[model samples]
Structures are given as C-alpha cells and as structure tokens.
Target: MTVVNKLTRLLNITYPIIQGGMGNISDPNLAAAISNAGGLGTIGVGDLPINEAVYKVTEMLKQTSNPCCVNIPIAVHPNVSHIVQQMINLKVPVVSLSAGNPAPFISLLQQHKIIVICVIATVRQAKKAEKAGADIIVCEGYEAAGINAKNESTTMTLIPQVVQQVNIPVVAAGGIADGKGLAAALALGASGVQMGTRFIATKEAPYHKIYKQAIIQATDESTVIVGRRYNRIRRLIRSEYASKLLEIENKNDDPAIFFKQTTENYHKIGAFDGDIKNGFINGGQIAGLIEDCPSVYDLLETMTADAKQILKQSLEKLE
Candidate 1:
C-alpha cells in the first residue's frame, strides 16, 4: 500500500518528505534539487525582504516544475505582511511558518488559497497551529539545529502527543538522518518526516565546505544552545565561539555582551568567512550520523528505499 496524504498528493511528490528550511542554507539551488528528486523542497526566505524573496521564488520555480515551499519565520523579522503577500502573488506551492503562531498570516495566504504548514516544538504549539488553519504541522524536537523555542521538546515524546491533539497531518523532525528514523516517526503517527541536518550534508546545499565537513565529523554532544535572553535559543555546533559563549553564560555574565559579540561575528566567522574554529556551526545531533556528502537526489533515493525496506520488514514480522 502507498503511504499517501494531502502533503504527498498536493505537493505531487513520491515520498512524504519535506526538506527542512535552513536560513542561508536552503537556497534556490538546493530547494529545486530536492523537489526535482521527488520530495518537497523548501527555501528559507525567513530573513529576506519581499523583493529578494520574489526573485528567489521565481529563480527556484525556473529550476524545477515540481512544487516547492517557502519558509517565513514571522517572529524575528519585520515586513511579515509584505513577505506573505509577495508569496501569494508568486503563487508558491506551499508556505512553512516557524518561530511563531501562524494565525495572523493564515487569512492572508488563505485568500490566495495557498497551502500552509506550521513548525512547532511543543504539543501545545501544534494544537495552536492546527487551530490557526495550518494544513500540516511539523513537530520539531530539541535535537534540531538553528533557532528553536525556549520550551524545547524531544520528538519521541512530542510527536505522539501532537498526533493525539491535532487532526491535521504531523511531520516529525530533529535528529532524523536515515530510514530508521523515518520509519520510527511514521510509527509514532506522523504522516511525513522533515530533516535539516541531513540535507546540509548534501552537495546542493550552499553552506560552506567547512560547515559540511563539521557536520560529518560531529558527535552527539557537538551541539550547544545559546542566545536565551533574546527569547531565541539556537542549537549550534560546539566551536571556539560557542565555547566562549557558554563560558560567559555559565558565569552568569550579561547576555547583551554575548549577543553583541555573537551577532557581530557569527555570520562572518561561520558563513561568509568559513572560520570553523571561531565560527558558529548551526547543526543538529544528526550531524554525527552523516559520513559522506552526496547529491540531494542520491540522499533522497537512499532514504526512501531504506525506509520502504524497514517498514516492509516490520509488517512482515507482524504477519
């Protein structure tokens, strides 16, 4: 039997997989590549302005005929309305919202009849998102990379709780790299799976080579959380900068100083300059599971094939 749902049918993808949108990582190239590979690809326009976002959407659409998604994290940035209207005007297939309740933007996108998916870290947040007219709810665990909510929850516990509370389809994320994780998420009542760290190890991702290498050589404890005072806690790879940040926090030092120092150099040291030592590596615990960097197509093929095999075997054992 085929495991299909509104996501698969609406996105017209063979696998019920959605590429987790990572800021500065999920660009037009990577997004199109994943969609072309038979999964829902997502471009993170959470930080971009409306004009740039429109250009990006047009560029990405030119790359693939398949459906793709655009992510907007409304809590951090200004011009949320402009971005939402731009996405609607472009007719983007899907919009995945993170870091805030999507209720306010629901009506804006609904007018265009756009499909909306909201990312949540807790069951309460999931219920809120579903009530806000989210077509799909992605339950992200504490193990995820990048910016996460202060009230972080593990996917193993959060997924079942969210599935029980919401009638909409749930997609599980955080520390998912291979088929075993995918199968486990499905067994927990998620209709699909979303992964960011796994895709960062792909060749199409625009992140620096050093960042990808760091992901490959990382361990379960390689990640640390920082930036709590700003109401945004980010899980980043443990580097010299991250270590310093922790030291300051441990001593109960001023968060403003840490935020200033990090904001001043985090992007330059990590993204633009690719300074792996002083730079902050935004990644998840799943980085430890990845060894080699492959094309997005190859990665999806392996994941889907292995997941099918494992799931089929489990059913056979029951028989």
Candidate 2:
C-alpha cells in the first residue's frame, strides 16, 4: 500500500518516510537501499571534508537512480558553501539543513531546482524556515537522538504547532519508531515522518552489530541526555562512557571536555567500532520500541502496511 501525500508527490517517492541522516552511519549502501525501497534515503555529511562528502554522495548516486537527500549540519560543517556547491554540481535532488539558520543557502539550493527541507525544533523556527523558502519542514522534537533543542518539546506537541504555523508540508521526527507513530503524526497534521534511531537498527545501516543490538535491548529508561551544561544536549544509549560523560557534565566541567566527548570521532567509535565501553552511541526513546534488525525494504514495507491498517481501524472507530 502506498502512503501518498505532499511529501511523496514533491519528492516522487513511493512512501513519505524519510530516513534520518545519522552522520557516519548514513553511508551509500544504506542510503541507496532505503531509496530503492521507496523512501528517501539521506547521506549525512556531518563535518566531513568536502571531497569525502562528495565521494559519498557520488557513490550513492551510482547505486540508485532514485531521489535521495544529503544532510548538511551547517553549524558543524567547516565548508558549508563548498558542500552546497558540490551538491549543486552533482544535481542532488534534495537537501536537509539543520543546526543553523538555513536562510542563506535555501535560495541557492532552490535556484538549482533542489528541494530544500529545513529541520526545526520550534514553531518560530518553522515559520522562519518557511519564510526562507524551504520546500518542507522537518520538526524534530526533544525525544530525537543526537543534538536536540534546548526547549525540549516532544513530537506530540511540536508537530501540530508547526503545522499550524507553516503552510508548507511538515515532517514529524523524534520518538517515532513504527506504524502507530506514523499514524499519530498524520493525525497531528503532518504530511510525513523522519526516522533516525529506528533506522540505526536496520541491517543495511553501517553501524556495528553491537550498536544495533543495543537498540533492540534498550528500554524506555535506557537512554540519557548529556552536555546540558553547554547547551548542546544530546541523547544517547546509556553506557559506561556516557555515564562518565554525564558525570563530567553534571560537575560543570570544562566546556571543551564536554565538547570533546560528543565529537564525531566518539560517535564513530561507538557506532562503527562497537566500542561500547569507551564510546557512546546516539539513540532516542524510540530505542525501546525496536525489536529486530530487518532489511530496509522489509522494514519500510511492514511499516507502511501497519500504518494503513492502523489508520483504517482508527477511522472505523470514529464511524
């Protein structure tokens, strides 16, 4: 069953699900797999050098002809301008910007006929992104993994407010892991959904087996937020390293120390190297909901089928 909406029509995808660009984990294999499976796959170029980032995108393009997206963490990428130029040169179909004002580059991307989606965590940010000419808005709530907004609004509250504030299509993120969550997002007035933590547990994801297993075993209380003192709050699966990092953060340790703990290198160590004791893995409260590591195609198929059933049942209830 196809879940069509503004997002699907705009992107020409079979489903409205957009895979979260989980930095190092969003490699070509997984991105292409997701895109090939009918959803928009994303390659996250979080702080990667321009050449390497371009190589990843190029590899993904080679693997699949379907539309895919590249995520640019503006605040962390040292060469935002160069990255955008590369995406334009490659004729990338979609781009999602996060962690900074997207006003400067939104027009530039749109000029090249690229669909730009801005990730926002607040109603004000949604309005600003829409005004900046963003084709779509992905409202990420506090329950999301990785870096989150200081205000920490949950998806249930943030999606409706953003939908009310923006005329453009809205994609809900954070704490959403299954078909039930997708139905809830649609009920909240969102046209689509973005998933990160749940995707991390998929077989195609480049993260280590241990990382995927952790997600399967995680409980509702298994996650924790670190770096609150520095205002760069991040959610992660609680582990020895994360606990220590939290200890330092709680003590009001040097900001640099806290910063070092959350760098991309540590993320790679935990996610790719499976160094759970000394490295940290990003995860959301949705970790508790994942049960297995299925292929991307199987997962999306199941999710879409389940969503249709859930939505149909919900409508029957109202009747």
Candidate 3:
C-alpha cells in the first residue's frame, strides 16, 4: 500500500509523482498547487529572463513552504550562469537541469545542499548525470511533449535501461498520465513518474481552456512528430500549425524558418492565448489517456491510490 520509495523519501514528498517543466509558459500557481498537495511541484523557467524566473520561483515559495523544484534548460537559457546563481541564492530546495550538461553545476548546487535532478532522454545521458553527481534522474522518452531526443526512444523501453544504468533514483517521464501508468513505471524499476501532458489537462495548469480541452480530446494518433528531418525532434498535437511546420521540414533541409515558428513566443500563443492556427502547443502521446481536468491534488491522490491497487492486483494475478 505504500508508495513511499527512494524518490518520495529523497524529495520528502507524499508520492513520487512529478510535473514536468513547461519552459516559457511556466506557472507558479500550478507548481504551488502540486507542492501543497504533497508532491514535488516543479516550476519550469525554460528560457525566461533571470529576473522573471526568480520572481516566479520566489512567488511559488511564498505560496507553499513545501519543498519545490525549479527546472532550468541549461543549454538554451540566455542567463544560464545567472539563473544557476539565482537558484542557489533563492535556496530552491530542488533543481532540475535539462537540455545541457549538468556536470558543471551539480556539485555547485549540491554544495548549497540543493538536490539536483537531471532530466535526460538517453541511457548515456542518464549515466553521465549520475556520474556528475545528480541525486535523481528524470528519464524522458520520445513520447514526451516538446523537444525530444533525435532517436525517439520510448519510456517503456528507456526507463528500465536507465534504471540499470544509473545508481540514483530514476523518475520515468513521457506517456504516463494515470495510476496504471504509474504502476507500469514502478514495475519497470522506475522510482517514480513525471507527467507533463497530464498536468496540462488539470484545472490548475493555467493553460488556455482550449489547450486543456485538446488534451482531454486527444487520441493516440492525435500526436505527431515534427523536426525529425532537421534533427529538432519534438512531439506536439497534430494541428494546422504542426502540419505547416512539418511541411517546411519536409521541403527544406535548413530548419531556420521552422525554428522561428517553434519558439517559446509561439508556444505561449497557443498555451495561453489559445491560438492554435499560428502557434504550436506541446503534448505527449499520453494525452489519449486523460479524460477529465481534475484538480492537481485529486490527480495525485487518485494516481497513488490506484497505483497501489493495481500493483497488488498485478502481483496476485502474476502469482
């Protein structure tokens, strides 16, 4: 009946369910709600200015005394060093680093007693993060939303390999949105699960109503892969905008025009403004599994309860 494990204990949360960082469209209220609900809520800073990112993190901290994490895309942020220093200054209890090498900052953050969680899409990256002294590993598969690895590995196949490759606790991400998914991840040796698309469908996620609805109505084939030709490798819900982006990729080898349309500003237009025609919104393949836009607390609670039940049932059936 216990969901308590290395990840929950390490992060000092009630469950190991985590919300993936949403980059530029990051919201503090959503992050706070998750933290207040006894899970490690993460505020994604994406490519935000250092001041803005600090303001968001500070606001989330004010809303909840519970330990929360900040996600920084290390390689892309304009203020990488400054943001890293700000996270240290703000004393953000946990920090998740992605899209870049975490080696340089892992020890520095740990020196301040901040727990480091590295998000990687490949086995090699997971091992490297562990060696770089990451306390946890968030192994995201190609089924995840937004930018992905060029190889497009799935969570089902990736998690166990990463769990075996890294010594630290591994949190499975991509294509996980329910208790069944949670049960599956644990069975695969993952210490926990991180969900992005599922979070967007929740009441607290701050995405446009239309954006959330899109997740609720999504089907397995609703998600399409773009940028494969140019090595951008992102997953998003199929849309006129997505099709146009794909068309560009197919027609031209250079991704300059495609990259322009896929920037965070464009993402903001879809996620916040509900402009689906011109802006692209990120969604994972797991969108097919979501049916309702529950509160974050309800989502986590049900996930843990159901996971426990399913795990017990699965063991009995197997035996």
Candidate 4:
C-alpha cells in the first residue's frame, strides 16, 4: 500500500495518484476502474455539452463507490457556470479545473463542500489557485499530452517550485508514466503525481487498440509538439495526421484551418476510431515507457510497489 500522505487523505484515495481528465474520448468505465482501484479517476469534460458531461459523470459514479474527479477545461467548454452548477447538483466528490482561470469558480465549489484541484503550469498560477480556495494544485509541464500550459514549465522544475510556494498539496504532472516517475515527483516534494498518457494505455481505457499499440511502440523521438504557431501548444504523437497538422500550423498563420483539424471530433476519430490518416492522437513523452496494456488495478499495484522499492533503494544508497 502507498504510504498515507496529505494528498491521499485530502482526496480520500489510497494512492496519491490522479488521472488526467483526458478530454472528449474519456471513458466512464475506465475512470471508474481507476477510482475503484485506489486512485482518483477523472471524467474529462472536453467540449461536451453540460448534459452529455452529466451523463458521463452519472455513469462513472454508478460504477464506483469511491471518490471520483471530473476534469473540466474551463476555457474549452462554452458553459462553465452551467457545468459547475451541474457538478454541485450531482454532488461530485472532486472537480479539477484547467485551461482557464479557476479563481472565479473555486469559491463557488468550496461553498458546496466540493474539493477543488487546479491544474497549473507555473508557480504564480499555483499560488493564485491556492489563494482562490483551491484544495489541491496539479502543476502540469510542457511534456504532458494535449494542450499544455502557456508557461511551458517542466514537471521536474515546476513541482518543487510550486511546493515551496504553495501551502496546499501539489501534484506533479507531465511526462510521468511509471513508479520511478512517481518516486521522482515525491522526491521533489510533491504530494502526488497525475498521469494522462500512461492511463490511456490501460486495458479499461476503452480507446482504440491502434492508439494503445502506438503508445507501446513509441520511442523517445516518437512524439512532437504542434500548435505552437497558433499559440496553442499541444503535444501529439508523431503520425501522418499529426505531421499534416504541424505542416498547416507552420505554413498557415491563420488559426482557422489548424483549429478545425484539431477539434474534439478529430481527437475522437484518432483515439476511438483508430484513424491516423485523418485524425491525430494526443500523447506525452512518457509514451516511450509504456510497454504493455495492463488493467488499472494491476498498473496501480505495480506502480506503488515499484515506487516503494525505488524510494527505499535511493535512501539506502544515500547512507
């Protein structure tokens, strides 16, 4: 079992692991499985309408008695207040806000006794979230999949800075896939680690086999950063579609075509329909480390075990 810590206690989870709210193609079954297995699972609210998101939350809640988190990208979804109200009405155990300023909604969620975790990429933003009544801070780095923070801080560099600056628990995200990565985050004084790309390769994720296989087959050089020219930096797996997207982003300064090609529908096409020719998949640099597709339970079990061993070995070596 993972050692008791502020994060686990705060989130009411056995492990200090939080799943990233993988937008659009998020699976309720996959989220519930992670929650049931001791980690905090999140239902990603991409651009889905409020009703559709509510349905997903309901399905995820029905499958797991444990606490679950709903990850909502504040700026991506048009109806932020409506969704927040739905979350309160549903009495969700946790809510993670990202892709926009969370200060406005933090107090509202706290009023209803809902735990709030803000995903940030800089120390200033981390402190801002804490000041805004956020219960936890998930500091994301540039190496993470999908849309990254505008500041582009690395998890290794951002974690300690956020921890030193914020009084609340800090969860390190970006480029983390296994136990050793978790151990490194803890060593940097983070309370836990949040993973996205790693969980996508799990058995319960319900994504396309081709997507999972791509993750398994990925190498250190397999991923590339796109959308930089349009000021929307995102990490994506290097594929024909991804390359095409990058080409458009580079040659075309106008965001019209780039935005059209990288919408939620395209993401679903790549992640769920396994269409790489016309759709692109999101992945982190950690994809290189994912060699197998295990069940969520087994993945968590092995990670905690490995983290414990790795920490112990490091301590011994220090002595």
What local distance difference test score does each model get? 0.82, 0.91, 0.91, 0.92
Model 1 C-alpha lDDT per residue in residues 1-319, reported as the tens digit of each score = 2346765886578788888877644578888998898888988775665677778888889999988898988875477778888888888888988877689998678778788989988878888888888889999998898888787788899999999999998999998998888889988999889998888778888778888888899987789888775565888988887887777666755677676656524644685467866767788878888899999888877877788899999999999
lDDT-based ranking: 4, 2, 3, 1
The TM-score values for the models, in the order shown, are 0.93, 0.98, 0.98, 0.99
Q: Choose the strongest candidate by lDDT.
A: 4
Kindly list the per-residue Cα lDDT of model 4 for residues 1-319, writing each as its tens digit. Answer: 8659999998889988999999988889999999999999999989998889999999999999999999989999989899999999999999999999998999899899999999998888888889988999999988899998667788888888889988999999998999999999999999889999999989888989999999999999899998888888889999999989988987997898899999999999999999999898999999999999999999898898899899999999999
Report how far off residue 318 is in candidate 1 (Å): 3.7
Candidate 4 segments whose C-alpha is farther than 4 A from its true place:
none
Per residue, candidate 3 scores C-alpha lDDT tens digits across 1-319 of: 2467889999999888988998988899999999999888889898887788999999999999998999989877988888999999999999999999999999999999999999998899998898889999999998999999887889999999998877899999999999999999999999999988998988888889989988899998999988887788889988888898988888987779888878999999989999989898999999998899999999999999999999999889988
Which pairs clash in the backbone of model 1? none
Superposition TM-score, candidate 1 onto the true structure:
0.93
Candidate 1: worst-modelled 10 consecutive residues by lDDT: 263-272
Q: Which residue pairs overlap in candidate 2's backbone?
A: none
Ten contiguous residues with the weakest lDDT in model 4: 148-157
